[model samples]
Target: MSSPEPRAPRYLVRRWGQLLLGLLLYGIAISLMIRADIGLDPWTVFAQGVARQSGWSIGIVTIVVGAIVLLLWIPLKQRPGIGTVLNVLLVGLALDLGLAFVRTPEELWARILLFAGGLALLALATGLYLGARFGPGPRDGLMTGAHARFGWAIWKVRTGVEVTVLAIGWMLGGTVGVGTVAFALLIGPMVHWTVPRLRVPAAGDPPRPARRRSARAQAAPA
Candidate 1:
């Protein structure tokens, strides 16, 4: 027997809830980064460094980075959707808010634990948010755009971007340490695991037409 079609309402509601929860988890992940005090994520590190050097708010720095990344999407023919815009704004705001209240851990072990846990949660949140299928994050969209335009492998493109950003941020006095390395290594797996678990509408659900019965063949068999 064929399986019944999945309900749209069930999928939509679950996706929406996951999106909200994902954002919150992202916020907590940033908070954990702040508390860890080892280092920020490469992108966040860049934003923080720019903020420090330019005397701009971290949020403003983030907006600028995201805007620049978004502009790259034009040549690649990737339109900015609601989720994309939200990701650009929300991530900065969430980071700023998280930093405001999250105090740095005093002990080394505490910091290390926070860094590992935070990195995992951040990856998980990214996957959950993306599973909504609304759009990709600005940085992610930028990487994808570059991959399409330059014909570079995604891993190579991503590694180059991360390395360049991390080096610049470090030169500008952003923290670069064990946490940065940990994030780079572990985030991919965490996202791969979490995204599949969040409920989203299946793209392969469209119905296929039933095959016509061959009357001659059927009569011979009977």
Candidate 2:
């Protein structure tokens, strides 16, 4: 089903606010994970690697990487929305700010708490921004674009990309530990739970009818 159009100005404002807040929280979540000294998600690991190599902050590397990834979308015929641009810009700024204010706790228990909290917050942040329905972030766009262009399975595309980044990041001195495995196993289910509940209802949206799977959809693998 198609999403409702943004006809009301108030809903538009709410969407924008949700998107910005989600992005900001996403950055802070990353900072929490970093301070926890646990393993990071693949993209963040890549950013950490690049930061280590370049002597830049992880946030700076994230921005540069996002911009570069966004460029690839042009060839894939993917259109970027306003949220995409802000994601590339604001997430990095927020990450830096978060790092400045959030310190690493010396206690292992505290560190674990931070990591767990970060993981949960990251899933929620993902739902919030995506629920706003402005657009997918640059990294997500890259995966979807590749799937569109190459007809690759989405899981294959995601796994391949993440594994490659993780390998490179590890080689470049990024941390890899139990948390990476935990993130991989938990995030998909977490996002699944969050996204549907978190989505912003369109202004004047009608109640949706229960959907039955089409033959093609039913035939598809779970």
- What is candidate 1's TM-score against the reference? 0.82
**Cα lDDT for residue 180, candidate 2:** 87
Estimate, for each residue in 1-222, the C-alpha lDDT of model 1 and write its tens digit: 455645678777777776766766786787688579788878878877888899987766887899899987898877877778877777777767777877777899988988888888888888778887768888888788888888888889888998899889888877877787777777778888887666375656545567877888668855
- Whose TM-score is greatest here? 2
Question: What are the models' TM-scores?
Answer: 0.82, 0.88
Query: For residue 54, what is the lDDT in candidate 1?
Result: 96
In terms of lDDT, the poorest run of 10 residues in model 1 is: 199-208
Clashes of each: 0, 0
Reference-based lDDT, residue 112, model 1: 90
The lDDT values for all models are 0.79, 0.90
Instruction: Give candidate 1 misplaced runs (Cα > 4 Å).
Output: 1-10, 203-222
